[model samples]
Target: MSILNSSALRPSSLILIGIPGLESYHIWFAAPLSIIYIATVLGNVMLLLAITTVLKLQKPMYIFISQLAFSDLVLSTCAVPKMLDIFWYNSREIQLSACITQMFFIHLMLVFESSILTAMSFDRYVAVCNPLRYHSILTHALIAKLSALSLLRAIVVIVPLPLLTLRLSFCSRCIAHSFCTNMAMTKISCADITVNNVYAMFVSLFLGPVDIICIALSYSLIVRLVLRLPHKDARLKTFSTCSSHISVMSALYVPFFFGTLLTLFPNRIPVHVHILVANTYLIVPPLINPLIYGLTVKEVRQSMYLLLQNCKNRIRLWASSRVWR
Candidate 1:
């Protein structure tokens, strides 16, 4: 029996099934996945560029938006390329160390994104609730400190996850999802993963609820403050300023919460549905976040338009010079 058990153990290299039950459609899936990944990268990069070059956008809110864009870029880049590889090239063999590293970055980015969103909410709260003191409260120094703290918090929270995973003995080396996630890897371990499960639950319960409550409270205060504003236009403008943030937050968290629930209750949901939701949870925010900001925020839109016009003018000048030559 011991010999049989030893023979049954998988190799150190793990095979990632891009979408377990949908293997036949992996080729079809890769196209859209690639498109989303490309769009995400381009959109976020454009947002970052706009923020960096545009003087008018050098405010606290845009700074936080740029940070969020950076986080989305990092998060999507960490997962989507590997996912595309699995789907397009059938290159699914990921080493244990590599998988652990991937899991670490993915979770780190997730937490960092959450922290940034929380910070953005606080920024909004200060801007609307105490407009007179907004600049005093959210100074450039404070923004830098908050950004640094967000990264540090993410590192502190996510560093142990891979370590805990490393302690386990993985009997099965096949990950059902496209990416190597902590939960997915934990489920494959032959050891008693009760501790890992508990830790994951602890993190989720602590982080998710705290972020949600803080955001909800911030918005609640904003709403109340807006209601008390005597001018309807003032209230409308304040609420409008918040709508983009709300849309981005919803895009980031809703699918994530739903995906977490699906993971917890995997038996109720179909495997394909779970996988799709998980992918969406990972992919959708980065893809849509820049679009939300670009379309909703006037400064960003104006900056993007200016940048495009410059590019067009440069191209036309080059063509004209070539004709003269």
Candidate 2:
């Protein structure tokens, strides 16, 4: 019987590699992954709150930063907790329904993240290219509109993905990744995955390249405008404002695009290279985004400082009131 046809056997039966057995692998894998998960969740939350609660961070650029952080928050939440379970609890077994839900959220967040980058680039373009019109261009109403458009873009593009995936018949239910990633899941399917694979290709070509191109074009325009300014300090500061973003964008996109290509052309790469590139592509961007923003963006750093002070003051006030009581 084909792996997919034997539905009676657990899907995890097909996917797991060496590690003695299910019980041992769970304990070993779960412990270290837990640390990564905690930091991932905590760091992103702190970044989000720092952006939201600080009055000085209410500008358009920071608003986009907050939106990006929020999307990463949602993305990490969907993937990491389940990953922790598989590692710690010997619970690699997943219901078909849960797998579908996981896939949907994963792609949704992916689409939203790319959309946010595109929007942020546009925000920079307007700020640097047309400074006088920036406030007028990026008003509260416009921010709301952009957010709505971003969400719509994700839903419209990725909604078809799940529907297409549902049509695939599983040949072997085992998924290789720690969690039910799309390519891993598709690999186990018995049915022809041509349509689903084609759709994945469409995402890479249309949504993926389009976002990267848009960001590059926006920055190119910004650079051209910055060069026209007479003040040396202004030109340098403008480039500095965008340098972190450009760096993070490269970090996120370069590996991501290569990983997508590697997945599509598995024959072109060695197994170890494929695995290393794919994992790095997935993990590094999520981890580094908050760090880049925190270090490079003055507003985020100041807000974090103020938030820490506020927390200390609150604790001291509570202690004093308790002593009086």
Candidate 3:
């Protein structure tokens, strides 16, 4: 009898095989992963705080950046802690409901981040190509609406994924990857997964490519406009403004593109390599996004410097008082 056809009790929990073939080194892997996770959280939090509290950063671009920071925070928090649990404690058991929940949020944040990047690209396009109307066009109200719609689109598309997973009877409960994903879950399903596969394909084709195309187009036009500027310094200044966003876009899309390719051509790649790329896809962007923004954007850099100075002064004052006492 086929494993799919055999009548077995529906599993309540699934075992995640974290980094297959690397079980012996899970503890060692946890060390660097823990540091990256902590840095992602702290850096994103600091960026969020700086964007929110600083009066000078209340502009539309900063507002979009804050959204990006928030999304990164949520994305990292959703996956990393569970990954660490598997690494450090060997706690591989995850409930079916919990797995579905994790899958939903993971995809949700991925789509949200993509949409936000597209929106940010548009923000840049307008600012560069139509400087006179940039403020009028990308007002706070419009930025809020764009952010809301990005989130809404993600929720609407991703909500059905977990429900679809629920309809399938799994022949196996062992997830080869560290995290639950649509493909990972569906791979174990006993039933016909045509609908699930179609939806996944639709999301991959529609969301990823559409957003990438929009971003590319936006930058292309921005570049054309910048080149036409009469003053060299003005053109340089305008181009500099886009450098940070371009860096961020590269950081995100390059790994993601390769990771997707590895997933699609799993036969060509080793399992451990696939797992490493998969983890890097989620970890690298969040880890570097804040640092890229802080170092590249002048306003954010200045604000962070000011914040550190204040912290230094407070620490010095406290130490001096303690010595006097």
Candidate 4:
């Protein structure tokens, strides 16, 4: 009976490793991670407020930035706090379903964020290369369609990962990562994971370079047009507009592709190294994206300043009311 039960037993929850080799140093790891998480939340929230509340920021580029902010917020919030939990409190037992849910949302946000960045590049392309038609080309309706398409594609592409995970029975379910990933989940299973690997490759291939390729083509075209322009000031301005998006693109894709490659062929790499690369791929972009857009993009910078100033005025008014009362 014991042998039979052991063969049929499926784990109800899985253990997440904070950092495998450095388990004793998890508290130290939490310090920087917590600080980054706080910054990401504050920065992205401020960006969202700046874009949504400011009338002048309702333009295509800012709108796309807001969408990107939302994705960053979701992605960071879904994974980072849980990681902090594992690091600070040793609270690493995640229910199987919850782990899968986290994995699903993390990948969903990644795909959606990539889609928004690609769309923003196109926004820049139209604005720089075909300045006259920018308004007609990027109507709010078009933005809505693009956003919907991005979301739908993310859902369709990522829904399979968790489902594939769910089908596999796990006797030993200690996952060697802070957050649940499809790769990490599959690694612990004794069952054949060929289907999962192939599907992962399919998802990766379909979702990965496609965004980079689109972004590259859009920028290349924009550069071509900018060079042909007669005015030096106009070229400089064009380059300025493209720079923010490029910074964001680099923030995401560089570490992302490197991490993905490591995840796919994770043989020689140390487990701790794999966890570090994965954590960096998710956390670094969120920390930097808001700062990149806020400082570099003039409209977002000015709008966020005004938004924060307005909040301060309201806070002062409230304080005065309390004092008078």
- How well is each residue in 1-325 modelled by candidate 4, as lDDT tens digits? 0111244347887788778898999999999999999999999999999999989999988889999999999999999989999989998888888999999999999999999988998998999888899999999999999999999999999999998988897657678788998988887876789999999989888777888889889988988888998999988987988888888988888888888778656678888887898888799998899899999988889988998899999999999999999
lDDT of 3 by residue, 1-325 (tens): 1122344347888888899889889999999999999999989988988888899999999998999899899888988999999999999888989999989998999899999999999999988888899889999889989999999999999999998988998878788899998998888878899999999989987889999999999999988888999999999999998998998888888887888887778788888888888788799999999999999998998887887788799999999999999
Candidate 2 colliding pairs: 3-171, 4-171, 4-172, 171-190
lDDT (0-100) at residue 217 of candidate 3?
Answer: 96
Once superposed on the true structure, which residue ranges of model 3 sit more than 4 Å away at CA?
A: 1-8, 315-325
The TM-scores, one per candidate, come to 0.94, 0.87, 0.93, 0.95
- Structure candidate 3, residue pairs in collision: none
Give the C-alpha miss distance for residue 55 in model 2, angstroms. 2.2
On the 0 to 100 scale, the lDDT of residue 29 in model 4 is: 93
| lDDT accuracy of residue 133 in candidate 2 | 99
lDDT (C-alpha) at residue 54 in model 3? 92
lDDT per residue as tens, model 2, 157-238: 8888778777777766656565556677678777778888888778878888889889989988988888998999999999
Stretches off by above 4 angstroms in model 1 are 1-10, 316-325
Identify the candidate with maximal TM-score.
4
Report how far off residue 7 is in candidate 2 (Å): 9.2
lDDT of 1 by residue, 1-325 (tens): 0111232354567888788788999999999999999999999999999999999899999999999899899989989999999889988888878889989998999999999999999999998889899999999999999999999999999998988988888666678889988888887778888888888888888998899899999999999989998999988998998999999999989998988887778787788898899888789999999999999988899998888888899999999999999
Off by over 4 Å in 2: 1-32, 230-232, 268-273, 316-325
* Decoy 3 TM-score against native: 0.93
